[model samples]
Target chain A: MSLLGVENVTKRFGGLLAVDHVSFSVPEGAVFGLIGPNGAGKTTVFNLITGNYELDSGSVSFAGANITGKPTHRIVAMGIARTFQTIRLFSDMSVLENVLAGRHCRMRSGPVSAMLRLKWQRKEEREAIGKALAELRFVGLAAQAENPARNLSYGNQRLLEIARALASDPRLIILDEPAGGMNELETAALVNLIGRIRDRGITVLLIEHDMSLVMKACEQLVVLEYGKKIAEDEPDAVKQDPLVIEAYLGSGDEDF
Target chain B: MKPDADNIRKGAYAAVAVLWILAPLYLDKYWTDVLNNVAIYAALGLSLNIILGYGGMFHMGHAAFFAIGAYTTAIVNTAWGVPVLWLMPFAGIAAGVFAVAVARPIIHLRGDYLLIVTIGMVEIVRIALVNNVFGITGGANGIFGISSPSIFGRQINGVVAPGHYFYLLTVFLGATIILFSLLEHSRFGRALKFTCSDEVAATGSGINAAGYKLAAFVIGAVWAGMTGTLYAAKIGFISPESFSFWESVIMFMIVILGGSGSIPGVLLGAILIIGLPELFQGLQQYRLLIFGIVLVVMMIFRPQGILPPAPRKYPVDKLEKQEVSL
Candidate 1:
């Protein structure tokens, strides 16, 4: 059985169809990639999966449970976490607190216990903080943990967003445009990070415009055009798929 | 230095509590009356802070809760001869309950609409208190002969005088500050701040926005009601006239000037808004003008108020590896 599955998902904004009858299933521990041209509804797919946008029609199942119409937080708690294309960190919050906010779903202390800082709550807080620190370290951001999230460099901010999502201990992680703007060295580092995430047994579905990074990091790739999946296959195969090559490389009528 | 801040804060609270408790032993009658008013206003300002500062609910109808508490205490005490002390909590709870009921739907409105609704709520409450002539409410003239309850085996009515009441008010105010301080630091407090800063993000993170918002409304209402009890006892009289639009404005000014979301800032704001007017009563009408100028200057120069939220820090030692995309 697929670990995460979407069947015939269709999203519409008025007369415009953002994603039309798109269906895909990701097996547990697979590093999957969703790629497209600029207007290919890639981020829209992420939104549909993460409950950030309501689906006009379709169904989403995670871990064999129907999650269609579930609120974002509930979806997150159900072991699916996502990072945004824009990197939405709590700007005024501390680096650690941003992670703690994600860990909010994991906390089990009663209000009264939290108030009195009972032994259990204190221990839990310390443990959560430790976990947050570990996640930050996992993303190579330990040195900047004490600073406000907004003050971090743009790349660190993106890393912080990923760390925050990871802190939720998701069964499946969706990263939207994880490598939208990065140099060669940074893309290489992201390839390693994606590998580490998969090694930890978390499935990843990432959207990317950077073909090199996506092709290197993703074992399987799906190509979308005008809100429809044009092709899906192994990276090497998809690269040569006539539809993908024609749609993405622009029919080779011009530059190499 | 690690322990010094906590110690100083505790010391400040302790010193204030002691001074107020022992004040009747030394202060003259005139000073006692002034102190009583200060206590009442301080309590009112603090309660307003819970809503505006901590909960991020901007309420201009807080004085309405104060009016409700005062009226509840007055009616219960006068009609049934119940001790004012026993009636205080009941009044506060009653006011809180009313706030929750009315605000559940009204709080959905934001900014100008919220301001209008709250202003309307206060006016309606005031009118009800005054127009209910057939009912137990004394109307425009107000409730009188309302007596204070006994404490420590002595009837604390007109006998020990306003000075004793001043002491009681101080103790009540101290307890409130401590209670509010704890509430602010709790998960509830954090949740409220999150909701205030970004409701969408907060709700997306799994917080029940409606629940937190309603809780803030009710908690702030209860605080307002408690302050009313203090006012009723301190003055031994309350006309509908006392709880007015201007009073609500005064409370809002205190919270904003002090800095919303900061406990110490609210207290400091309360002192300035309440104490400054009293100290400059000789300035009379011009005193209000001066207060307005001060508020305007503060808003223009230091919009974050006397104390902004302290920045939170990340633990730098936790970074594992750097991945630069560019």
Candidate 2:
């Protein structure tokens, strides 16, 4: 059974087609990868699925519900959470507070309740703090929970983003370039982290440039080129696709 | 939260409480009146801090809401012979509803553009009042003979005793601080800060960026309106000149000068912005000039204000920790 399905999704930016008729589905609890060359629109697909951009055509569904054109927050509420290509931590806020902010969607207490410190709000707040800290502990940043988020190291910042996304209590988590600025060791740790996340019965949709990490971490892969889905297969089979090779290494037809 | 930090914060709170309660006793009538005035601005500053500080919306037209609130209280009190205190909620609602209408279309504009529009918003409101759009407003002369708020059958008026007004304003300020502090730590506040920092990331994280911004704008206006009610009752008069563009500027400066998101910073900001010139009254000719230079120097030296909000603290010790997998 699939948890998230993108059917013939398309997105255009004025004159340019950012994502074109891309279609794929992630099986429940599987690690799915969306990979292509830099401009192949992997991030755009993530944006479209997450409702950051309205699909120019087609539709997206999660958990058997058509969520096409829903607002980003609504998409998130329906068990989809994502990280940016560039790390977007709430800098100047404490690391724990950053995770708690992610937990904002899960908590239901409104402004009046919050201001009054109503019994229900306090209960939710206490539970939220516990969950946020647990997320930090999961990401190995519980010790730095009180420090400013921007004070985290590059690798830790990526981990922080994952923790933040997880704090939203999403069943499907999308990560865009989760290992973008990571070194080899950090990438190795991230691969292990993704495996841990998968072990916890959550589905992962990843957009990564690191081929080695993609192949090692993602069980299934969808390859894109020029906004078109060129390949979809197991990691081993995806490596053997000629179209993917040409897209990555070039076809030797264009003038450099 | 660490024990030591907690202790320090508690001590600071107690110290502020003592000072707030004891100040009017030691001060003369003029100084007490100054204290009351500063307290009003402090409340206004904290209210605007929601939009400008946490929401990161550059709203220079806060006085528009303040004006709406003051006028609401004044017009209603005069027309119906109702107690000003009874009209507080209406004043807040009027400003809040107006804020929603005006802010909805323009909330998406960024930084300087939003600032310019808000500036225009206040001017439009001021012009409306000056022209007596509804005829309830007394035009250029503005509304007068507004009643003082009575508390517990005892009249709370600046004329009978500035101390009574001081206590009333301080008590309200205390409530605002308490409620706002709780709000600062709440999910909504966190969401607003997130939206302010990065709308794209915040939206991606399941935050309604436009909704949160609009909510902050309205909440700020509601509080400002209530503060305006207090202002009307204290003065027993309202005028177009009172809620001017410069008043908005001063409120804006209070938030920034004290530390935009920090409550104590705003209080300190109100003191300096409203009290410094009075303190330097002996330099009658050069007081305004000296004040400007001091503010310029302060801004240059401490761009973040006197006390930017400390990072939020959470109880991590209570969480049952597990080892991070290598």
User: TM per model?
Assistant: 0.88, 0.96
Give the winner by lDDT.
2
Expressed as tens digits, the lDDT of each residue in A143-253 for candidate 2 is 899999898999899899999999998899999999988999999999999999988888999999899999999999999988999999999998888888898998878
lDDT minimum window of 10 residues, candidate 1 chain A: A108-117
Q: How would you encode candidate 2's per-residue C-alpha lDDT over B1-326 as one tens digit per residue?
A: 66697689779978978987999889998999999899999999999999998999999999999999999999999999899999999999999999999999999999999999999999999999999996889999999899999988888888668998999999899999999999988888888999988898888778889999999999999999999999998979989999899999999999988998888899889989997779878889998788788779988999889978877767677654533231
Residue B168 in candidate 2 has what lDDT?
91
In model 2 chain B, where is the ten-residue run with the lowest total lDDT?
Answer: B317-326
Top-TM-score candidate index: 2
**Interface RMSD for every prediction, one decimal?**
6.1, 3.5
lDDT of 1 by residue, B58-143 (tens): 78988899898988888888788887888888888989999987898887776678888999999988888889755878889999
